[model samples]
Target chain A: MTPALAVRGATKRFGAVLALDGVDLAVFPGEVLALLGDNGAGKSTLIKCISGVHRLDSGSIEMGGVAVTMGSPAAARALGIETVYQDLALFDNLDPVANFYAGREIAGPRWLPRGLRLLRRRDMSRATGELLTRLQVGIADPHATVGLMSGGQRQAIAVARAAAFASKVVILDEPTAALGLRESRRVLDLILRLREEGHAVIVISHAMDHVIEIADRAAVLRRGRKVGEMRPTPDNRQAIVSLIVGGDS
Target chain B: MTTGQAERAAPLSPATGTGRTRLAALAQRHGAALVLVLVVLLGSLTFGSSFTGAGNLGAIALDASYLLLVATGMTFVILSGGIDLSVGSVLALSGVLAAYGSRWGTAGAVLLPLAVCGLIGLVNGLLIGRARLAPFVVTLATLLFARGLAFAVTQEGNQVYIIPADLALTRIGQANVLGVGVPVLIALAVFVAAGVVLNRTRFGLRVFAAGNGDGHAAELMGLPVARIRVRVYVLSSLLAGLAGVLIAAQTTSGLPTLGEGRELEAIAAVVIGGTLLTGGAGSLGGTLAGVLLLKVIQNLINQVGTLSSAYQQVVSGTFLVLVVLVQATLARRRRQ
Candidate 1:
């Protein structure tokens, strides 16, 4: 089957340093792809290129088999490519529903009267509550401010933010970086939920254990090159780590 | 606010707080309104019926009208985590422009100041929002620039353009409805409109998000961050311009120093209204209450008969500092 999202010959550079050298990757729907790499291994650069943060010097990204330039972040979002960065990009002072629908908030008339559109509060809140519950994320109040949530809860919301609108791909960068053990497990569950719902999820994580727990496929990068691809099972964790570190051919 | 504070507060967004914490948050949000109520009660008891008298209350409302107008715009700008220091100068410039335009008729008088002041605000917005300059620094520069332009127009403060009492402009500013001053009515209208726009509209959510969310993240979310920033500044300046026209009509002359330091007063009102100076969390409701509270206090001081008028600033400054300190402590607790 054609991949939900595909990247081919993705080459990026910062001055003289090659951040991503002809890196090719793809993910099918209903599958989790974990990007495994050590620091400065072109993981974030690849994500940025795919998510439209930076223009690729030489590469092409496709959503559902159509070549997309992704000229801007908005363009990427329009193509159903949502990236939840490590920071989560949420407004702490606002409620969960507000953060979940910050930019693409449900407003009146079904035809937004531009900036003058009024929000449909009940609709947004109901949608948010349902999304959280579907992932089994324990957020009891949709009106509660984001600043009052736990790490795991925040991660869940960020995942939901990406997955809810993402018809093509959801990219998560370092989702579990700040989460605790239970929170990390919750995030893993959320990833599986997204995959089960037939969304393509790409998680960039340093935690090999997490990648092993949820990822259907693992792609390791070393020195900006695609080094290895494997199905990370309990026994193959050591082999994945070795590939990530460029330990052997 | 720092990104660190924002990140730390992020996970805590779903605040299922205890009753006590909820009460504290409520108090923090509506503290300005509560204080306004308490002050009104005390003033009424102290001055007896005079404090609540229609005549006395009417005067206070009228006095607060110009301030309320300016504070309405300030509320939006602040909600986006920005400051507009040029408001005072823009008010002065607008007054001068209106007085000058009065010769042509009411339309000219009203539209000229709005046009010029709106242009100034647009420039302020572009500079700070699109150019990515420091809001404080950019607005401070504009304050000087606007003041200079106002003086240049007035021939170094020597020329005072006068508005004849019979003119349409004067009538609009000077006339009353139901025994209330026209400015008061206009201010009330502005408050209603602004309250709706700030709370119920999609643009309003963007203002809060821009102030409260990670800037990069907000951009990725498809919010027109630069455009929103520019619009808030524009709104603030336009409102200040309108306030100037009304005030000029009341005085019947454009005084170069008409609204000197008025921007600070407006900022003080916004802060006391429970709007965070750092942006992200605020309401126009709190701003109205803050303006009333300050005006009422000044009125009470006037009634004191023994105290000097200078005490007005003293009290205002003290309230500003106290409110800020309380907010700082609360924010710290939330971060922790």
Candidate 2:
């Protein structure tokens, strides 16, 4: 099967530092690809390049086998690529409905300029409610702003937001870094659900057990290059660790 | 599908202390309106016909008209997480420019001041939005610059240009419909239009998004954060300019020093309306109530007849402090 998203020789440079050096990666639909690495291993840089936060110095990205150029996050989103950063990037002052559809609001009169368009609040609220229910992310008050929600709830909302709009790829960066044990488990469960829904989910994580738990495949990076790629299992868990720490080839 | 497991997990309540928290939220949002109503009641009970009389009420609305316009613009600026210290100066400059331009008729009187003030806003926007300068510093500099220009236009405050009483500009400024002042009507119209834009439109949502403490998040979410900032600053200046124009017409002359300290009054009104000084949450309705509340208090002090006018500021200052303290406490409660 054709990969849902593919990167070719993704090279990125920040001044003299080569953040991503000739790295290639791909993930097919219905698969969880875990990006593993230590600090400064270029995991973030590679994902940033893919998410359109930063352009690759020399490389190409193909979505569903179609080579695409994304000059901005909006451009990337237009092509069904969504990234939930470690921060979650939620507007604390906004309610779930507004936060769910901040950039891509369901507003009207196509002829009117983007700013002048009136928000279809009822439609947006209905859709948000449906999405929350589908994801099993429950908040008692739909009118409550996201700021008041728990960390786990906020994580679920962010992931659900990506799942709602992302048709091809959903990249999550350290989604459970700030969550507790139970909350982390919930997020992992959410990721598995995304995989079941046939999305190409790329997760960046430091937790080795989490990778072994939900990841269908693991690609390890070390010092700006792909060190190894394999199916992570209990048998080869130590081997994956070795690859991440550059202990052995 | 994780269906059974998902169903087993209970829905989390929005807050731990639901009843008390919700009440606090409601009060924080609508407290200004409640206080305004109470003030009017107290005044009526104490002063009788003098306070409840339609003539007195009309005068209060008329007095509130200019501050309402300035505060309305301040609402947008504060909502977008920035402050424009130059608004007071811009108001004074616009008034002087309007009077000076009145020689060329009403069109010149109206357009010239707006053009200059809008340009001032544009400069402020570019500096704050694009250059990423500190808003406080940028606008503080502009406050001095605009104030200087205002005095220069009137030859160092020596010459006050007076609009002819018979001129259309002056007549329009002083005009009243059904015993309501023209400035009051215009202020109301501006507020209504602004309310729709801030509450109902996509731009309004983006403004809220832009004002988030973490603006970088808004940008990542694909909002035009810089552009929103620029538009809000320009919107603020234009409204202040419009207020200046109307005031010039009413008084029939532009005094370079007319709007001294008005920016503080506008800020006070906005904060008293329950807009967070840190930004990202506020309402025009609350600001309308805030302006009215301040004016009503002033009128009430006047009704007392014995209290010095200086007491008006003292009361307003004390009220502002009280409201802010309440807001801060409520915000902490919500976060918890």
lDDT of 1 by residue, A48-136 (tens): 88888888999889888989898878889889989988888877778888888778877887565666777787888788778877778
Q: lDDT: which candidate is best? A: 2
**Quality class of the docking in candidate 1, CAPRI style:** medium
Minimum summed lDDT over a 10-residue window in model 1 chain A is located at A110-119
Q: What are the runs in model 1 whose C-alpha is more than 4 Å off?
A: A110-112, B1-16
All candidates' TM-scores?
0.95, 0.94
Per-candidate total of colliding backbone pairs: 11, 0
**Number of colliding residue pairs in model 2:** 0
The single-chain TM-score for chain B of candidate 2 is 0.94
Give me the candidate number with maximum DockQ: 1
Question: Could you give the DockQ of candidate 2?
Answer: 0.47
Q: What tens-digit string does per-residue lDDT give for candidate 2 at A1-249?
A: 899999999999999999998999999999999999999999998988888889998989999899999788888888998999988889888888888887777888889887678888888988988988888888766767778788998998899989999998999999989999999998998999999999999999999899999999999999999989989999999999999998754
